[model samples]
Target: MPLLDATATHPITLPDGTLYRDTVYLKNVISHPRMEIGEYSYFTHCGKPEDTAEILAPYLGHSVRERLVIGKFVQIARGSYFITSSANHPMTGFTTYPFRIFKPETFGYKDLPVKDTVVGHDVWIGHDAAIMPGVQIGAGAIVAAASVVARDVPPYAVVGGNPATVIRMRYSPEIISALLDIAWWDWPVEKIETNLAFLETGDLAALKMA
Candidate 1:
């Protein structure tokens, strides 16, 4: 049997053989116009499945210009959320407060510079981590628990703390480049399954050959 089922809403089965409903394949649950989610990207949240997109990105409205693009195999732990560019208040004026938001007719911040928030493939975001607007987290990156990521995260880097400084790079630049070239997340499931040993064992030579 295949380990991954793209159609499954509740993908995780606990050791007791009960379905773990808190975890869902994001692509199946999210139907937001401003969001683009890839396959096998699961998010663990206690909220209703229908509200997954809203819960994950509260600031992203249907008419918002900025998008939230999350790539394949992203594992987002419980309470992690993204704050998109739409949430930013205008900074050019004297006050940061949004006066225009109070009135329905006048309510607008459309002129504010908006940039899409992107999460690359095979990324793992730990519990309660918050991704700031316009931040691009690269492939194979790990954002630690309770992090507030305000800047771009490099590929294969482990980051943590407020503003999310890089704790360390998971591999040397050469290896990282090689892995990016391999891009196993883009492979067919059968090919990925066949090469699982190399991936898990960090056998670069074997992976290259595979």
Candidate 2:
């Protein structure tokens, strides 16, 4: 049996002529409408990616609408799960029982203010990582495997561990600044191909000249 339906929708193609489906290591069970995944950004669900809208009142003091925005050229490894709004529950109640969720007529849904989880361009997320909601991962950040990201990650920083602390920066401060200014991820396909050598060689002079 196929992992995804034959008629399932796919919108992006990678540099090596592979569809996003080919790179996705897990099952594509749901179509995410609340997610705005940009060019070349992909995820592996481990066959259990979260895409639910129902937020239990116990988990959340109120109901919340989840949104995920991923930017271009992002690399996501297998077994990575994004925590959706459904998983973010209230933390401060005498009893965590979400009676309001069961009895909507008796208690109307309360709205919880949850911001979108934003992943910036050229970021790399390693295997089995769990990214929490409302976290903003900056451009060119590297998330180590098995990490649980709960906060904002700075641009070009490498982070790891349960709470995802910064391990190091990918490059020197000057280099990071230069790379961010270059914004190669935003370059056109033809330009990227043309300057691929400079990118591959770390030849800043060549890139600048081009």
Candidate 3:
């Protein structure tokens, strides 16, 4: 089934097979490209008619694109901000402060390094969360509402605050690694859609047996 419908003039940016469960909604998805949503993900109230996951695509200008690379069973309440190029600034100048003052003309930060932001499966990024550029949220991570994530999160960890810090770990390393190795989420789309019933029952082992 289609995760979200699109207008004839505006197509939803989701890739060929994006599954869903519980409550999931993506209002508009134009300009968003290479989108890959997972199970139980609900993204609502998209910004701008033209804004899309493609917003993450790199460009040569002062402005940067917005990105939201969510994973399976994510509960992103509302107003979660994900910026792909928010990290770069003019590094050549004597002082980085000057670049901020210059606004659009900060030329020194050209070709700034870029890293892909990864959101792990079974993540619960609460409402109004702001995931900074280059942050990789590990699997089963929980980012509390209104928290600002500025660093990498470990698997099954909980983080919250302005510059979110790891307050706790939700699982042992062994289990987390086991789940990662299982990688059920990476299964082919048609297989998932066809075997939806088995998955609903939580018997992922069936995938292994098959």
Candidate 4:
């Protein structure tokens, strides 16, 4: 019902720069400390979106929005850095000795032209990881801890590295083929609830397997 209880056991405050187009899309089933979070989402013990200690781990930036974009059912370990945007230096012909250095950011300093950090549903980011800007992490993907993601990840894929590389797909192309055909998650809630057991464990060899 209520997203948060003002009387939290510990300090909890609304986070800045975190926004959802629709509030109904945000859900908080558990509340203990003060943190800014999104819906159908739960932060891990150290998953506080801001402080990483009392609150969800925060980034180095002045605005939290430039750091992370989490999707439904994500589990991000502590000390993860999502650098969605930064002081991108003008490398071409500025000739200003150290152009990399930022200069009192102008009109475009606060927000990126395209807010492009994304995290898909049921994804898990391990401890001490970093996600870079303009990166789109696909649904049901797993990013191992201590990895660095630099490119786009495909759905249900697993990636890790200094510049994250696709180690492999979670499921064989065949298995995924059937699962896609069934598209069980799209089923009505009532239907899914009734068939949960089969969907969760049944090995789809195809046909009735689906």
TM-score against native, each model: 0.98, 0.74, 0.60, 0.59
lDDT of 2 by residue, 1-210 (tens): 322232333434568977664343111333445656666555543232233211101122223465777787677776676775555555566865656666658553345456778889988999888888789999999999999999899999999999999999988999889988888888776777788889888998787777
Q: Note the residue pairs that clash in candidate 3.
A: 24-42, 32-53, 32-54
Q: CA shift at 100, candidate 1, in angstroms?
A: 0.8
Q: Model 1 — which ten-residue stretch has the worst lDDT?
A: 105-114
Give candidate 2 regions above 4 Å deviation.
1-22, 25-31, 45-64, 104-109
The candidate maximizing TM-score is: 1
Given candidate 2, what's the lDDT at residue 42? 54
Provide the clash count, candidate 1. 0
Clashes by residue pair, model 1: none
Which lDDT tens digits does candidate 4 get at residues 104-170? Answer: 4442333324345788766788887877776888777889889999889887789998888998998
Q: What is the C-alpha lDDT of each candidate?
A: 0.95, 0.68, 0.61, 0.57
For every candidate structure, what is the RMSD over all alpha carbons to the true structure, in angstroms? 0.9, 6.6, 6.9, 9.1
